[model samples]
Target chain A: MRYFFKTIHLIDYKNIVPKTVIGLFIILILLIPVFTRNVVTLSTLIMTGIWAVAAMGFTLVLRTGQFSLGQSAFMALGGYASAILTAQMGLPFWPSFLVSGLVSGLIALLVGMVVLRVGGIYFSIITLALGEIVRIIALQWEPLTRGSRGIIASAPPPIILGGHELVNFNASLAPYFYFMICLVAVTGLVFWRIGESRLGRTFAGTALNPVLAEHQGIYLMKYRVIAFTVAGVFTGYAGALYTHFLQVITPMVFGLWQSIQIMIMSIVGGIGSLVGGPIVGSILLYNLGEYLSRLDTPGLQSFLFGSVVVIVVMFLPQGAGLVNLWERFWNKVVWREEEYEPDEPED
Target chain B: MPPAEILIEGLTQSCIYMTMAFGMVLVFSILGILNWTHGQLFMLGAFIVFYSTTAAGIPFPIGILLAGLVMAGIGILIKKFIIDRIKGELYIGVATLALIFALEGAASLLFTSDDRGLAIILPGVLNLGVVAISYQKMAVIIFTLIVMTAMYFVLNHTKVGLAIRAVAQQPVAASLYGISTERLSLIVMGIGCALAAMAGAIMAPLYPINPFIGRTPMIMALLAIVIGGLGSLTGAIVGGLILGFLHSVIAYYISYLSEVVLFGLIILILLVRPQGLFGASAK
Candidate 1:
């Protein structure tokens, strides 16, 4: 009976409420398509999801103690790869999408292997330079990338199940919205799992203190490269999805600003819970941006975004972003958690 | 195989990059963070110079000086309010980056996004035997030389220079020796920004002045500092010259491919010597 009761309790007291809330929130998100078919609303949600994935990737790289300023380069690589394969080479969309991610991952692995050897501010500068190089290549390589003119990508073909037209991309934004949800779910699941695993702890070790982690038998470069390559793969997928959704692939699509945007999202979202933080951060910021852009006030978006970041950093400090507010609310109010105190001495 | 004109142009480019890089290196050595908004500060300086000289009818030299002083004041305010409160290196860098968008946005809204010029400040060309360079370009070069010499004198000889160097090298030790790191940081930040502004103000005539004009110079300065070695002043100058000459000569030959080649070269150099040419080994 005790065992049964314990089993019913499931896990620690801390996780139960947050987990349940998150699960219910996800279900609510999944039902969003049914409730709203507004193009602006759906597209905003889709873009938010894409940015979230990218932000998650940025946070992952940060977890390994390396600041990657050029993550958007991988996105460009993926977008260009998928665009070339599908639009130019007449390859199927699904296969091209997977291939794009692989190609991006391969490039990332190679770059990480070489650059992670330096592994500090130098690595960051190299990544920044790398983003520029990729953009330049995309711009100059007209034969491959269609130069600055950009390439038009077609929508994914409709899904046919048992001789009935099921999900159609051409019909409405619903399919794209659902697709984005699935991608975010899968990416978030994988990232959350990694965070729960021993690998996450090792990553923390390296990030907290590299020298101590190294002395403890952790190969710093290997772990750093692993985190980077993983991030590259997902960021590539996000890029491919973004390209296909926009129905265009151009050198101007991804650049230094986008890279910085991803960084901002990660930082503002709070790096505490990789999955939750990015999703929340990107959603809020992307919506804010969309609204600000609609106002068409010159520089307002930039100014507001900058001000938000400054305010967050000033108030939160560390990596404690907006998500920290949620955690604080839970601990301070809902849970009524007390400060650490030792039990009275019984002896 | 580039002509003397390109060489002179490269020299002018080198001067701008060198000044920018020197400021960045100085800031990095003292503040322990990369000021990502340094580029926007440069743009602000150019605008100050442009408006002062053209609209306010200030003389060119006075305009440049005004730009420097105004930028220095702005820099001090930023350091005091934003940077000082930030704890970690990463957050501080991001905070400065935030300043970039804010500054750029403010500049765009205030100035409108049109391209402006200051070429009227120095109109005529001075013809040398091998190459005829514009007077504005010549002035840029001469002004840079004077600034560099003056900076060298101040840094090497002045008591304040000793204190600044002391703080940069060992902040805790400097504090023990009755030097205030807080004061030094503010001064360094001021001077660093002033240098960037002056460089921008001087170059306003040579290039189109827009809110976005600061981007390329910022990138070039960053590259120069990295190539020269991050914390080394001399390295910044050498790197600036190398990058400037390489940029002009190569662009003259192959046009846009120079950037790719330049990045490739930087990566190769980093692969071999990670700390840069003059940078100290990683701790």
Candidate 2:
């Protein structure tokens, strides 16, 4: 709950900004289906929940000055872990979800132990390579992943929790929608707490000045490894949820560009800013991509993304995503007008 | 012919990697920013030749020269207009990545995204013993060596090269000596881009050419430079050769696992020596 409220603080509530503004935005996301009475469209929001989860998980390490370009790899691993184990072996749903996430975490922990020792551009390049390696393995590991053709009909778990048997997947999308909402809520809470915690402070210090942090007696390498390993866990969980949502695991989803895309989303939104990344980054990027494809020029839209990045990085060093509009306005108008002369203070 | 053939083939492959890697290393050593668009520039060079010979009705020799000059002009212009304005190494990197995407977009929009084959030159085999190395293979090796020797002569002997080297080695000291460090950086990039374009043109005949084809080889070239040595020209050449031979041999043998093998080697090298094989310890 505090995590939820903390994100509220992340919002700009300072200058008598109407509470209705924020309230209306939240209501719009929640109450859209009610107004339209179309349950089908809620599906898009469900996937957005998964994107939120993955971004939150990724933000943990990215804040530590370590960019892991292996999100798609971890994601694919988590998705396949659950989909295969449950679909093929007939494992129960609850156990599969937990096991799938743990497997991704375990793999991440192992990779992190080895990979996180390297830093900066080298770290980014290596992670990207590792991602491709994993994707290639997934492509070749036909027995488990079904190769390039991908696995089909991997619907939501058939097993009922506490003996409450579930129906077909389409009929149960409503439940999955709320299920996603819960996942996002839980993820947001955990991520916010971690961001505000001692660990987060350590990460920030380590990122800014590792040598200084080390002199302060902090174990730099250990904390970085921890951050990366922990991030893997959440990304894995997000993947597991995403698998159920898509009900399919494909090699195409784990592409290197896709991994880069996720990275771009986070950075474009804003690093070190909570929830802004997923909202401003993932939702918008994903929506824009879809809108472009619908508008009959996917290539043109992608070109615009590249153009936008060039413009944004050139003009606004601070990302345009999730920026403080009010602060900008106040600085320009109010602060200028309120400047009093020093000579007037003679009394 | 048997073993000599394999050796010459390997040499040709190594020559390609070495040339491209040298270009990358030169830019990085001078600017400290990895030009992510380098691969595109390389690809652009190939397209320049392609467009020149096919569309503009230029002879092979003239087309190659024209393509090199065209690509270099673009590189120099990019450095002056966009990259020179950038503040820091990090921003330069981000900006270069943006350029890669934008160039890819422009290329795709202008040309088909499909692969385009270049006209074959020196297309015959030379039987050495058991190995029969092709004429094109020998030509590639000879051309690369020529480029390398040319670059070496210029860098070691010429006044401009000396100035560029001076600035790269120590910018503050060079500035005290009244050199424009910014102009020197641009010159370094321009030359690097020109060399990269030449590599692209030379290799076009041997491989598939496409707009986005620059990325993989570019990344590999960067890795090669890192593994060889970040700043040393000698390291760049040696590293490129090693990566090229390994990539070709591994791809031929393991097929799909080539990238996996390449990345695995990169990780291993970084873990062992992040400074690279030829790279000097950072100051």
Candidate 3:
């Protein structure tokens, strides 16, 4: 079986089973809407997807060796932009949605240009402050954001195929689920490409040793800005989708806590694989949070969340997250790979 | 010109920020990772003081001291078990961040989330022509001054302080010189947390206490440290004072718009001086 697995080359796999399994897993997820359209299940999955995108963005920024503590601020910016454009100004949902991501990306670009110049704990502190600033703005800017009362966002209009409604968002969540799947897929694909490309290598260089990378003629700020901006764009999209799904945009929705949540999701998921880590981490943590939230306990969710993170960090130690465990299992149990060490000669 | 009342409020704000910022910067210099639970620790400190003073009938001063000692013990445990074991700065940060939720959650569960006011520790007012400051506020200021002085003396004049400064400057060399970085870290963590607890305990009487009250002050302290320059004790003080006064003056004129303006100022400051006002250039 090992020999057979080694013989097949789907993408550069010494072991092909994991790849095939991952492909099958994606197919199965795509087929979830067909199997069951249960509201509870679909909404949970939708939220997981939204959070996954946000987590992926966070992981991408982390790739460049910069900790972004205000990721939710971008989410808020995106949500508010889309919410105001659609609900207040009466713009079409689809166009406003696109604009939301762009608006978020633009802000990230501007902020990144200024802050990425420093690129350290300073960046982290500034971003944290940015989250609070965005929240305060959303709260005080009553005419636009409707203050703390929140702005209600309408769901996407139904898709018409040959004069018949194909997917009506308001009628069922299946459409929304499919939409979420597409968003995650697109984001995953782009992130995966980035990770596989030279840009990703440059990001690794910057992260591992800034001085060495700079000496190698890599403009650290440029790559940092790029990673931050790209993450911002997708985070914005995720935020916009989340607002439309929830049908409301409130200042209370995204702030320091949400940003921390995104950071936790990304870290717990493992930063090993850009796309896979975030999806796995967000799905696991988000589902866990949802379950805990339903228990009617005040602090159980937080306590459990903290405990889990603490445990993961203690065990994982490095950048190895939950995905690392899966890899270890495959290598040790399934592959039965033996350790390679040269024998030492004793006198 | 800002009124004297605003200046007094700023002073009160600055004292809290200075204590919190000072402790945080000290910890960061030694631990090399910001204790994300610093705020939660502050909250716990307030809870501890409130219970001891009100329920246990402990004297107010003694209650504050108890809060500090307990928090120091907690901080030491966190450093030894959780922080010390975690390798890498990023992971340590995430670990501490998780602790925030855990600590906050535990606090909420144990104390409940309802607002509980600390019985007035000092019940009087210092009436000046321009403004009359409450005794509680005055206590906060005086307590902060005493703490700051004690810290300055310790950091500058003591053997342990010398070890701490050496470790912060050169960890490897300091370790080689027989100064146990591990032991020093534990002490620093204890001191940092105690300072945070003291700040919380001191401020307890002035505001309604809850498990979540640590959030705002934490952010303010964080901003203070950033502005003053991370890892610089004097910078933390200066930064705290500037932020407090700036916050009050801005809020007074523009109300809630102060938050935006404060953040804007941070960005501006960073653009001009990335290392902060007192921070040395990054290596």
- Write model 3 residue lDDT over B1-283, tens digit each, in one string: 9888899999999999999999999999998878888898889999999989878899989988999999999999999999888776777888999888998888888988899997787888889877899888889999999999899899899999999999999999999999999899999999999999989999999889998999999999998988888888889999999999999999999997888998899889878888888998764
**Worst lDDT 10-window in candidate 3 chain A:** A1-10
- Candidate 2 stretches with Cα past 4 Å from truth are A1-24, A36-49, A158-169, A172-177, A295-298, A318-347, B1-9, B85-89
Per-residue lDDT over A190-213 for candidate 2, one digit per residue giving the tens place of the 0 to 100 score: 767776678777776677667777
lDDT of 3 by residue, A158-246 (tens): 87999999889999898899899989999999998997788987886687778778899999999999999999999999999999999
Docking class of 1: acceptable
lDDT of each residue in B1-283, candidate 2, tens digit only: 2245556666776786787788878888787777778888888888888888778878766776776788878988888877776554444555677677778877877776789987787778888677787777777778887888888899989987888789778979988998887888777887788878878888878888887888877877877876787788899898888887777676766777777887898789878987778777732
The most accurate candidate by DockQ is: 3
RMSD of 3: 5.1
Candidate 1 per-residue lDDT, tens place, B1-283, comes to 7799999999999999999999999898898878887888889999999998778999989999999999999999999999988766777877887788888888888997799887667778888777899888889999999989988988889988888888889989999999888999999999999999999999988788888888888888998888878799998999899989988988899886789998899888878878788888854
Give Cα distance to truth, residue A12, candidate 2, Å. 7.7
Index of the highest-lDDT prediction: 3
Sorted into a CAPRI-style docking class, model 3 comes out as medium
Q: Fnat of each prediction?
A: 0.60, 0.36, 0.81
The lDDT-based order of candidates, best leading, equals 3, 1, 2
Q: Candidate 1, residue A261: CA error in Å?
A: 0.7
TM-score of each: 0.95, 0.88, 0.95
Give TM-scores of the second chain, every candidate: 0.98, 0.93, 0.98
lDDT of model 2 at position A149: 79
DockQ for all models, in order?
Answer: 0.46, 0.41, 0.57
